[model samples]
Target: MKFLQWITLTCTVLIVSCTSLFCNMAYVTNEGSNTISVINTATNTVAATIIVGATPIIVAITPDGKTAYVANGGSNTVSVINTATNTVTATIGVGSNPTILAITPDGKTAYVINRNDNSVSAINLATNTVTATIGVGVSPFFLTITPDGKTAYVTNEDSNTVSVINIATNTIITTLAVGTLPRFIAITPNGTTAYVTNENSNTVSVINTATNLVTASIGVGIKPFDIAITPDGKTAYVTNLDSDTVSAINTATNSVSVTIGVSGSRPKLLEITPDGKTVYLAYEDISFVTAINTATNLVTDTIEVGPAPAVLAITPDSKTVYVPNSDNNTVSVIDTATNRVVATIGVGSQPLAITITSNPQPPHSLAGKKKKDIFATQTDRINVITWSAPSEGISPVRYKIYRDAALTNLAGMVSASNALKFEDHNRKNHTVYSYYIVSEDLNGGLSTAASISIS
Candidate 1:
């Protein structure tokens, strides 16, 4: 009888300097000041601020976390920031008023939504230049790219429609009429379904990405402005602007699971932690943020931030959160463990949105099994392991394979290649052995693991 054991260890680390004072950074777009604030998360202070175009509203970071793209609504251009230098490296003219931005999964292209012109600009990341211009519904306010890097969905606020674009051709493949005014969109982790929040219609439109059709229209709180789905893709939380409540919907049944009321404050935007344990809400009319426990669907912590917090983002470690206070031009840093404001860093005038670069994530669908070494003539035994590249975030530079479950026993390492596989040669028969696999990015940040055992 033979026994073989396998274990996958996901080493997810923040891609930043451990030796230097600065580790992770948060980029905030200042609309009133027309600049970007770079906040160092380690010290909880502002590292630098770079000037950009007029009225920057949104920011998107590439998968590698080396570059940032800012949408300047007033100047109708996109400014590219080199993260290493913290400077404006390039500025590409987009459209009349670019309000939203999204980067593809491959990190090669960026799509900018110009609300006034009703068009989208595809910018090539390599050259930092506009490569294509695609038209969509009127007054497109938000955009999201699928996990496969093949399609993009845009919500047109004025036209009450969603424009589906093919990334390869840079053209609108279809336009589906949705609720009265679709303001924001969120895609599930698997990229199988997209949920669109219609502001005027007060309904959530669920779309099937495969057929590009509306699967269900879920009634929710009044004037739903923003939506975010859990990492597991099981539940979605929608913030109702006017009703001062958040509607949690079960993705499986497309039904409202619970409606948590924020009686005094109006919830403007929200995000769920990567671990899917807590849901944070930022209010436009108030100065505090509400943290809800995902398991119990109840309010766990109410943290006081700056005046009129506009938007917020959580770090990959799920230990810290950064919220841009639009009224005060400052960012409130909250510690996840205590749910208190640890520091407040002054940014620019009217900080609207924030985005942080992510650490490399573990490869998907990792599996391994014992097999015969066909190329060898000595009747040797081997273990062949295979996986798909990470769905998003920083790409790995190499994969390390360990012989022991504790990951202290070094076996071998493989470079990131198209093969997406590793092999352990000359394995002993009828003996139990364990293998551990992890991904390492260029900056030496390790990924979190997914386990797969071989018999």
Candidate 2:
């Protein structure tokens, strides 16, 4: 009998551990209700409704996935929620009418754009207090932080400009003129480029991060309001408010690649799935979340949500979507796999924007991972190569050497901790060979090909 009881206890613990590991959750900000709705991904159900500040317009989650900061437009404050408990722990006062918010990559600070005050308020996440207020243009609407978390690009609606703020100093560094009534801003994953949607001009401005200048302006559709880029950073989707269409842009050429029509009227917010396979858009009047097939750039299905859907967010696993309905003071949860509305969660008044905190932890590489510079010199009968470790924080794993597209185990397994300098002694005179390195993480995740060639 005791053995049976021990066996049962072991099984119960295993079940609980597996459930916790697989159950990802989606979060939505209810602007009208001043609350946030948390939906369980596994069951497509409401896990919790978190009360926040008055009129929460946007919510940003910290990088570590521990806290969520909500911008309350009506209350002129930001609500900090503890993700573990699904409760508001603190409220930081900011400028008036905070419409949107973004957290730095380091998770140390958050930038809130005050639409009425025409300024950006910087909040210290540790203390939950507004530390700096920087003047921006008229009606600052949306803001995006660079991938490196060093700079913030904010769209000023009435001013038709983007205010660039240096995160280190908490000050406005420069303002680049974009288009009329710029409403949204999106930064590339590489932190090298930025895109801004001009609602009045129906165009998207491409800004070069290095120069802080508008490099190109691509005509999109009627009244583009929200923009998002794919995970690969190859394509961008802009929602056309008036035309009920989504404009897809090719990042390489900075041109409109295609235009996808959304059956619902007034598509307001757009979000891409983690795998970059699907896009979820919220339509206000139609009260639905439309799912688009990214491959063909066409609407595949529409999941009926709450009344007057304001914003939407996708879970990190790409299995669930959360939509906030302004009119109903509720949030609708959608199952991505089945393309259906699974649950409706009640929250505080008017939710404007939602962001998720589930950034996947990259795989760790094996030891002795070798790396070589793309540009290396070779002497007579000798090839000299210099290499460095891959980007930090990445997994430290093993390396596989390749020559002329063929795998060569000559270097053996090398540690990723040290930079390697190798000389090819077996090279034939006047022969040309291409060398490459492959890193394998503990989880078997492989690095992209990094290659060098020598003659």
Candidate 3:
């Protein structure tokens, strides 16, 4: 008799990216309707519509990929959404005009930047409560956390300075003066430097993390509002809102390498792909998105989306890009392979910010452990392989087992299936055998064996 047993999996607590070996989901905050639209990455459709706090402007997912923290600009509160069910589990009051979110790498806490209150609210992820309220600079609108999860950098628009916060103490340790009306902040992958976009000064201030001082101020186009760094940490792209242009900064030289013009589309914000090959820019008062090639620093193509696109988010595999149109009340899914709008998902009115839940799925195991583990056995004329089918966040859509290490010959398969175990009958006795198992999540994200030999 042939039999296969399925093991249930409990996902890890970290949410920065999907180590859970599952597909990603994009969450978009709708300011006009006090709701959030969840998009399924695979189908590019609205999976769920969740009501949140009033006038939510931005969102951040926890490291465990379980919950989304949303900042309500109008209600002065933060709504915590349970990603598994697409529901707002908690709503905690914050400062006035909470506009931005920066979650720590550890996923233990989230920092909310308040524009009118000149403060930051720290929420404890485990408890869903406001743990600390730290005062920052005047009118802080955007913030970024260090890769190490130790410090946070906030851009103060009214004071023209950047506030540096020590995560351990939840306090503003220092403030460094930058250009006029600093708006957005981004920290490099190496955690050594930070880039702040100064809107009024039309420049990007490069700050040394160790000294907390501006090391270089590279001039960009008019009203630089957003910044994105390449994965390799070699370049920085700044969107100039008024100039309708983007300035590429050479990180090594701390200078502007190229300025690509966006004709008639005032670029408001930009996000880079995971592979760092392209940059997607959202235009103000425009109905389309512009894709820029990072290599040539030129406009590669323009994709027509909805009216007045505001923010952008990319999946972990760099295969798709999500753009939320505030005016048209929808999110456009763009396939990176074609650079075309593959699907138009209806979200909510005035969708503002978007983020993906993330990569790194693991092989199947037996105990539903967060990490990878394997179990198999062979007896006279019978072979059985049983593993804990990772439910991760979403259940595995299908599972496959192979006899060879190369995974060429399909020994068994569960189509549109969730069976975790595979049994091979009529096998030769006293023969050495090897097998490989692969799993796919509901979001269409595949996690395969890194090595041909199943671990």
Model 3 — which ten-residue stretch has the worst lDDT?
Answer: 11-20
In lDDT terms, which candidate is top? 1
State each candidate's clash count. 9, 28, 14
Per-residue lDDT, model 2, residue 127, is 85
Residue by residue across 76-121, what tens digits does model 2's lDDT show?
8888888778888888888888878888878899889888889999
Give the candidate number with the greatest TM-score. Answer: 3
Using all chains and alpha carbons, the TM-scores for the candidates as numbered come to 0.79, 0.73, 0.82
What candidate 2 gets wrong by more than 4 Å, as runs, is: 1-21, 348-352, 359-455
Worst 10 residues of 1 by lDDT: 13-22
Question: Residue 24 lDDT in model 2?
Answer: 49
RMSD, each candidate, Å? 7.1, 13.5, 6.7
Ranking by lDDT: 1, 3, 2
**Tens-digit lDDT track for model 1 on 141-189?**
8999999899999998888999999999998889999999898899999
